[model samples]
Target: MPTILDIFKDITKLQRCSGNHSEFIAYMQNLSQKLGYICLVDDVHNILCKKENSNAKIVFQSHYDIVCLKENCVPEIIEDEYSLSAKDSTLGADNGIGCSYMIALMYERFDGEFLFTSDEEIGLIGANGLNLPINANFMLNLDSEEEGEICIGCAGGVDIKAIFNNKKIVPNIDNLDLYEISISSLPGGHSGVDIDKNIPNAIKLLIQSIKGCDGKILDISGGERINSIPANAKAIIATKKQPKKLIDNMKIEKIDTKSEHLSIYDDTLLNYLYSFKNGVRELNKELNVVQDSINLALIKTNIDEIVIEFSARSMNNENLKNLKDSTKSDLEKIGCNVNTYGKYPAWNPDINSFTDTILNIYKNINSKASLRAIHAGLECAIFKEKFPNLKIASIGPTIKYPHSKKEIVYKDSINNVFEIVKIIAYNLK
Candidate 1:
C-alpha cells in the first residue's frame, strides 16, 4: 500500500486544475473500479465510490479540482524535513490530501462512501450541481485548511460580474506617453480566508497606479481567478505626462508603440473599483472571524467593453443577500450591466451528535482541538443544504497559503488527521 505522500505524488502528476479536470475524473473512476468499489459519476462530474456491504454512518467528501495559477499547471511536489509543498506552483494539498486520505481508507477496504467533487475552486460548481444520492447520515468535509480545528459552518458567497461599454478615441501620439504598468510577486491568497490579511490586491494596485497619473486606459487585464486574491496585474495606458505619483510597489515600463486609440471609458469604472467596499465589512465578535467581505477579483478589457468580476462572502444568508444587493445596486447605479451567479448558501453553525463524535475523537488525540467556523466558502455548505438531514463537519491537515504557489501542508498534520479519520471509519459503525 502506498503512503499518503506517495498517493499525493501520484495525484500531482495528473493536471487537475479547475475547468480542466476530466483526466483526473477518469483517473478516479478507473481507480475506483480497480479497487473493487462501485463508482458512480454524475452529470456534473461528481464521483462517488461506495464499498460493498458497508454500514458506516459517515461519508468522506473532498473536492478534487485545484486552483492553478498558470495554464495546465501540474504541481511539482517539494518535500522538506517536516512538510510538503510545490516548486513554484500551487500544491493542491488543500483537498488533494483529503482525497488521498479517502483513497487510503479505500485501500483498507473501509466501509463508507468517498465523494470526490469537481471544479470547487471556480465556485462550488460540482457541489451545487451534485445530483448523486448520498445515504450516509454524516459527512466529513476534507477542505478546511486548519488542522487542530474542526469547522461546523462556513461563509456563503456569490460571484458578481459588471460590464460596460467603452468608447475609443484616436490618441495624439506626440503628446501622450504609452506605458505598461504591472504588479506581480505579491502574496496572493484565498479571497475569503485571507481578505483581512492586508495582502495587496494586484488589480487594485494596478488601478491605483494608473489612477495616480490620470492615465487614459487603452487596455487592462489582471487576476488569475475569481476566488483568489490577484497576485499579478498589468495595464496599458496613454498619459499626457509621465505618471508623477505612481504606486511605488508596482513595475513601470515605458512601451514604445505605434499610434492607437485610447479608451474613453466612464469615470465610474475607476470610481466603482476604487471605492468599492472591499475586505472585511464586519467582525463577528462571537465567531472572531470576518463576518462579511468582498474581493476585487478580476478585470479585463475587450475592444469595446470592460468586464469586472468580484466575489462577496458572508457567514449568514441575510448578510450575503445584503452584500449582493448593495454591490448590484452600486454597479447598476453606474449604468453597468450586472449579474450575480454561482451563489451558495451559508451553513449555519451547529453541534450535533455526529460532530460531537468527531470532536471528541479529535480532542482525544489533540487536546487543543476545537470547533470553529471559517469566513471562506466550503462545499460542505452546499451539501448541508442538499442533504439537510445529514449532519456535517469539516476537518483537514494544516495547509498554509492555499490557492497560491506558496501552499504547504505539514506531514505530521496529515498523519494526525488520518488517524482520526481511520478512527471515525472504524468506530462509527
Candidate 2:
C-alpha cells in the first residue's frame, strides 16, 4: 500500500471540483483494478472497491469532489512534510484527505472495502445511491479536519439557493458602468461552530456596500453551502461615473459578539455588532479555543441584485438562535428584505463516549487526541439518521483551512492517525 500523502498528492493533481469528477473517478478505478480489488462504479460515478473477507463488515467513507477553482493550482509537497500547498486553487483537503486515506486502507492488507464517494460536496449522492447488502454498520468517517477530535454528532445543513438575473445589463448613462464588489479576508471557516464569534459576512458586506453607495440593489445572494465559508463572491453595480470613488468609500463593520447579531450598512448595527468585542477570539469569555463565530462568506453582484452569504455557528443552541435573529433584525432595519437559510444543526460532543477508547489508543501510539464538535455540517448527521443504532466516531490527520487554497494536511500526523485507526479497526469487536 502506498502512503496516504503520495495518493493525495497524485489525486490533487486532477481538478475534480463538484460536477467535474470524472477524471478522479477513473483514476481510483484504475488503481483498484491494478491492485486486484473488485471495483464497482455505479452509473453516477460512485466507487466501491473491496478487498474480500467474510465476517462482520467495516466501511470507510470519503468523497472525491471539490469546490470550483479560482486558479490552476497544483498541489506541492512542502519540505517532505505531510502538508501540501496549492498556488491558486483550493487543495481540497476537506474530503480529499479522507479519500486518500480510504484508498490506502484498501491496500493496507485489510479485510474490508473502501467506498470512494462522489458529489459529496454538493450532496451525499454517492453513499445515498448505493444499496449495500446491509452487511456493514461499522463506518469510520475520515473527513474530520482536526486530528485529535473524534466527532460523534454533526449539525444537519441545508443549502439556501436562489437565482437572480443571469445576463448583465448596461446602465443608460455613460458614467453608469458596471462594477464588481467583493469581500475577502475575514477568515472563512466551518459555519456551525464559528457563527457565534463576531466575524464579518461578505454577503452582508456586499449588500451594505450597495446601500452605502446609494445604489439600489436589484438583487442579493451569498454563501455556497451551509457548512463551508463562502470563498468567492461577486456583485455587479451601476454607478454614475465614480466606480472607484463609490467602492473606496464603502466600509464594513465587525459583527457584534455580546448580542450575537450583525447587520450590513447600518451604523447602528455596526455599533451593536462590534459591541463587547475584543475581536472574534473574545466572543465568549468562558471558552478558551473560541467555541463559536460568524463569517461573511461571499459578496457578489449581478445585473439585478447584490448577493451576500454568511455562516453562523455556536456551541450553544440558544446562541445560534440569537445570532440568526440578530442578523435578520439588522438587515430589515437597513430597509432590505430578509431571508435566511442553509440552516444546519450544531454537533455537540458526547462527554461520555467510546471517545475515551479511541483517545487511549491514540495516546498509546504516542499521538494526540481531541474530543470536540465542529461548526460545519458533516455526513455524520446523514449517516446517523440512516443507522440510528450505530456507534459512530470520526478522526483524521490535522488539516488546516479546508475548502480554500490554504488547505494543508500535516504529514507526520497521517502516520499517527493511520496507526490509531488500524488499532481501532482491528481491535473493534
Candidate 3:
C-alpha cells in the first residue's frame, strides 16, 4: 500500500551504487518472497520476479543499480513542492523510480514479470549477461528520462582501456620547483546522454591549463567512473620556469618536495589526450540524435603505468565498430596497449502493434506524446537482440540532470506516469 514516493525514499536509504548493489539485491530477494512471487536471481545479480496466477503477457524491466559520484555515497532525499532530489548527491531516480513502479504493480498483483538489472551505470553488465528466461512476449522498459516520449531504439556502446608503460624515472634531486595543479568544481555529467551539453571536462581543462608549462609530470589522476565526464583532476609536475596562471577555476600552488626520484612522461602523452575527440562526432539528421560520440572518462596513474578509459557510443552497430576500431588504432599508434569490452548492439527504431498500443495509451494521458530514439545506451537494445520476436518500448518520468549531483525528478510527472502504467498493466492483463 505504499505510494511511489514512499518506495523511492525507501530505496534511497539503501546502498545500491553500481558494482556495490548487494544490499539492494538482498532487499529485492526478500521483497519477492514476501509478495509470494517466484524470484530468480542470476549470477550477475539480475532479478526476475514472476506472478503466476495472472495472465499478463508483458514484462516490466528496470536497472536497480545507480551511479555514485563519491565513494560509499547514499544520497539523502530532499523534496520540495514540485520535485524530489538529493542533498548535493545523485538522487538515483533514473532507475529507482522505475523499480518503484514495478514494485507498486507487484503489490497490485499485476499478472506480469518484473526484471531488475544490475551494473547498468558502469555498462549494461546485467542485461548483457542475462541468463534468466523471459517468457513474456512484450517488454516495457522504465529507464527513459522524459515523460511524453516513447523510446523505441537506443545507441550501442563499448568500453576501451589503454595503458602506457614506458615512463622514465629520473634521479635528479634539488632540481626544479614542484607544483601541484588541480581543477575542480566543474559541472560533470553523464557521458552518454550529456555529451552534447558542452559541459567542461575537468581532465581536458586541466591539461589545457598546463599544456604550455613544459613541466615533467610526476603523477596525474582524475575522473570518477568509466561512464562519467570528469569534474576534477590534479597533477604534480616539476618545472624549471614558474608558469603563470593560465586558466581560471584551477589552483596552482608550489609545494615543497623531498622525493629523490620522479617519473617523467613524454609530451606526446599530453598531446594525445588534448587532441583526442571527447564529444559528439556526427549527427543523425533523421533521428535528430547524436550518431556517434566518445567520452574520455577516466585516467589514473599507477606505480608503473598510466591507464586511460573511454566509453564510445553510436546509433548504429557498424558505426560503433568503426569508432571502436579507429580509437584502438589511435591508442596503439601511441605505443599503448589497448583493450575493448562491454560491447552492446544498437536497437533500430521500429513500430509494431505493441508499440502502437503503448503510444496510443500514452497519447491519451498526454496528447503530445511521440515515439523517439535516444543517443544513450539502454538495456532494451540488448533485449531486442536476445528475443527477436519480443516487442520492446521504454518510457519514464521527467528526470533532469541524471548521473550528476543536480539530478531531480518532477512529482507530477511521476504520478502521471504511474497512472498510465497502471492502466497498461490492467488493460493488457
Per-residue C-alpha lDDT of model 2 across residues 47-88, encoded as one tens digit per residue = 777755435456777777875444334454343444565665
How many Å off is the CA of 245 in candidate 3? 4.6
lDDT of 1 by residue, 167-218 (tens): 5576575567788888877779999888888978989877777787877777
- In candidate 1, the residue pairs with backbone N, CA or C atoms under 3 Å apart (3 or more residues apart, or in different chains) clash, namely none
Model 3, 354-383: lDDT tens per residue? 889988999998999999999899999999
* TM value for model 1: 0.96
Candidate 2's C-alpha lDDT?
A: 0.58
Q: In model 1, which regions exceed 4 Å deviation?
A: 170-174, 244-249, 257-261
My TM-score estimates for the predictions, one after another, are 0.96, 0.72, 0.96
Error of 3 at 232 (Å): 1.4
28 in model 2: Cα distance from truth in Å?
2.8
- Weakest ten-residue segment in model 1 by summed lDDT: 240-249
Tell me how far candidate 2 lies from the true structure as C-alpha RMSD in angstroms: 7.9
What is every candidate's alpha-carbon RMSD to the true fold? 1.7, 7.9, 1.7
Work out how many backbone clashes candidate 3 has: 0
